[model samples]
Target: MHRIIFATGNEGKMKEIRMILKDLDCQVLSMKEAGIEADIVEDGTTFEENAIIKAKAIMELSGNIVLADDSGLEVDAMDKAPGVYSARFMGEDTSYDIKNNYILEQLKGLPEEKRSARFVSVIACAFPDGRIFTTRGVFEGFIGDKISGENGFGYDPIFWVPEFGCTSAELPPEVKNAVSHRGKALGSMKEKLKEML
Candidate 1:
């Protein structure tokens, strides 16, 4: 099996990627598992740049193919805020709940139509030879009145999908995978992986 380092420590995301790529003859190992703790500076202004920064850092460290994703919620009403700074929205040390509450409070009194938003994911694949491939995906939805489910991470609970008739957190794993931003971005890379590898 081909082994690649996935530049993330989130177990949930790792699990989701693994499940999505289950049919492939590949293994996804985390940065920690690869015996490297390089602090990749993601000071980019865009998701694509941030993802490329992470993927390149990990690839250089491990000398293997590296895949990194930079994703976040883009609220239209908030002028697409918390875009690249999704993780550090409320503060560097703030928890997810705090971040969610902060957004909810900021969005108070906004109608459902005006609360439209989308999740954007950019995936960067960096090879040791300095080649980079990037793909982007977006899942359009709106912010719900309140946090609705407990199954997803990040801003999933507040992202309402009208077509799915629920928030991203309310959907099952398979269903979410089928329509998630990460899934769409990864799907874009599927053919590229086959052709390159």
Candidate 2:
């Protein structure tokens, strides 16, 4: 089977990526598992650019197919703040608990309609032959007044999915994966890979 390296260090994202790509005719390995460690700067002003940057950096180092994703929560109330900086919001080392609560506090007293938000994900793939492509996915929902759920990481606990009437974190892995931004992006990537594979 072909081996594809995914450039990411977050355990949460790794789990989701592995789950989503499990059926592919390829082995998905994280950067750590591939013994790759580099401080690739993601200075892109957009998610697509960041994902591409990461994928290219890892592909150059490993000379293999590489996939990378840049995803984040965009709260409309905050003018889509913490969009690309979702991981680094409130500082890179801050706990998600603190970050989640801080967002709730900032949007305190806001009406439900005013709390609309969405999760965005951009997946970039780099091939050894110098081909690169990108796909984007978005999950629309509201921001819960309080942090809740345990099934997800980052802003999942506060991302209200009205269709499910719960936060993204509360949904089962299978359900979340079916509807998540990253899931959608990966699904698109999977089709692309299938054609190439």
Best-matching candidate per lDDT: 2
Task: Enumerate residue pairs that collide in model 1.
Answer: none
Per-prediction TM-score: 0.97, 0.99
Worst 10-residue lDDT window for candidate 1 reads: 186-195
- lDDT score of model 1? 0.88
> Where is model 1 more than 4 Å wrong at Cα?
none
Clashes of each: 0, 0
TM-score of 1: 0.97
lDDT of each: 0.88, 0.95
Q: What is the lDDT of residue 66 in candidate 1?
A: 94
For each candidate in turn, give its C-alpha RMSD to the true structure in angstroms. Answer: 1.0, 0.6
